[model samples]
Target: MATSGDETTAVRGTFGFNAPAEVVFGVLTDPDRATRWLPVGVTAEPAPGGRLLVRGGGHRAEYDVDIDPDRLEVRWRPATGTGPHGSARVGDAPAGGSEVSAEVRAPLDEDRLRRLLGETVTHLRRDVEDNFNAG
Candidate 1:
């Protein structure tokens, strides 16, 4: 993913959940499941060219879906900032679970980038854990 203004800065995070690949994929692709763990006020069509909106706690994020059976990628541009492009990929984990990875790019210095990436990874991990446990 490339930042809005700086193409050189890239932030990436990967998380693994103890769920089957299809199950994890379903949770990611299904709007209801997505909202239950990710954000609020969500609406998604789960198809190509469809729009996905997530809003809550005075924060809203919108993205266009570019989906496939094995992957659901979105380019998110938020409402209140210089939004960077975002994409998430779900696949088989190395051990016996599913893994999801997301990348976001923004104009942040090296230290900020590291912190942001860490936070993103933690957030994704918690979300995926919650989704998996809720099933």
Candidate 2:
């Protein structure tokens, strides 16, 4: 679910996995696993200025990848102008699953922003769950 504030919008999704935090974290950090959940043709360099691009259907998103172990943040900039910003945090969840929370800030209206945030969270949750089950 997503929570909207005055200045920031956050969407948090949790999945209970049949694995430990370290195991889940490893999957989240692995590039091959990331591709499984992230949009198609998505590539992450896991460094500053590293490209994080996603393409699906007719829509595409590009951002700079910034990684900090348990946290991953992306600043989406499709054009030379200012762009939307987003971040994802991975933490230990009760039971055996890992919890991931994502927040995005764009120049879009409230409804559009909410929908985008929700979709992003859903995609990520499904991807993580799929990887966890496959492993």
Candidate 3:
């Protein structure tokens, strides 16, 4: 399940996953696992003040990473951009599984933000099912 709020400058979306919170958090924090689901090719340290390198379209840019294990959240912003920050947080869902709430603010329009968020969720689901549900 996915839900979105009405906003133009920023986009907020909640996605439901059939994976546990710890598993979801691990996928976000572990560099090797994260690279499998992240939209772009990224090399991140996954720590506070760590460098996050995003590569796509033959272009590469650096961003700062902020991770909070207690909060189950990770945030990042470009090292040079005026202001396009993004974050993803995982929590236990009401019924079962986990819920991932994501937000991207400024510079990116609502449509683009929604698309990116949706893409990430799709990849995340596939990865979890393939890696975690194998029997």
Candidate 4:
């Protein structure tokens, strides 16, 4: 889901998987796993003040990683623009499933924001199904 504003918009992408929150959170927080689903490449460190870049498609989302179990908030001042900062929430869903929802606030139109958010969540689904959930 996406909403519009004057120069900033908020977009969200939500997904569910039949896995534990810890497992899904690991995929989201781990740079390698995130790259597989969300970026062309990622370089990150696992602590506050540590930086990360999820770059691809001529754009990147740089973040000063502040890790937590249930929330992820990133604020990146993109030097050359074309990046975003977002917050994500991960938690347990019904029936032993896990749900992940990310909210992105950026200086972008609703259409473009929706596109990016959709792609990201879709990619996460694929990663979980193909790599982590494969039988």
Index of the highest-lDDT prediction: 3
**Could you tell me which 10 consecutive residues in candidate 3 have the lowest summed lDDT?**
1-10
Model 4 misplaced regions, further than 4 Å = 39-49, 57-61, 70-83
Query: Relative to the unseen true structure, what is the Cα RMSD of model 3?
Result: 4.4
- lDDT string, candidate 1, 1-135, tens digits: 334344446767676778766766666666554545442332333333455665544645566555677454444544344544566777787667877787766555656666755655554456666766887
How far is 26's C-alpha from truth in model 4 (Å)? 0.4
Which residue pairs show collisions in model 4? none
lDDT order of candidates, top first: 3, 4, 1, 2
The TM-score obtained by model 2 is 0.60
Candidate 2 backbone collisions, by pair = none
Off by over 4 Å in 3: 1-8, 40-49
Alpha-carbon shift of residue 109 in model 4 (angstroms): 1.5
Location of the lowest summed lDDT over 10 successive residues in candidate 2: 72-81
Q: What is candidate 1's local distance difference test score?
A: 0.59
lDDT per residue as tens, model 4, 25-130 = 7777676566666633433333334566555555545666556754533333443454467777778899887888778888878887787677777777777666
- Relative to the unseen true structure, what is the C-alpha lDDT of residue 30 in candidate 1, on a scale of 0 to 100? 66
How far residue 74's Cα lies from its native spot in candidate 4, in Å, is: 7.5
C-alpha TM-score for every candidate = 0.58, 0.60, 0.77, 0.72
lDDT of 3 at 60: 65
For model 4, give the 10-residue run with minimal summed lDDT.
Answer: 39-48
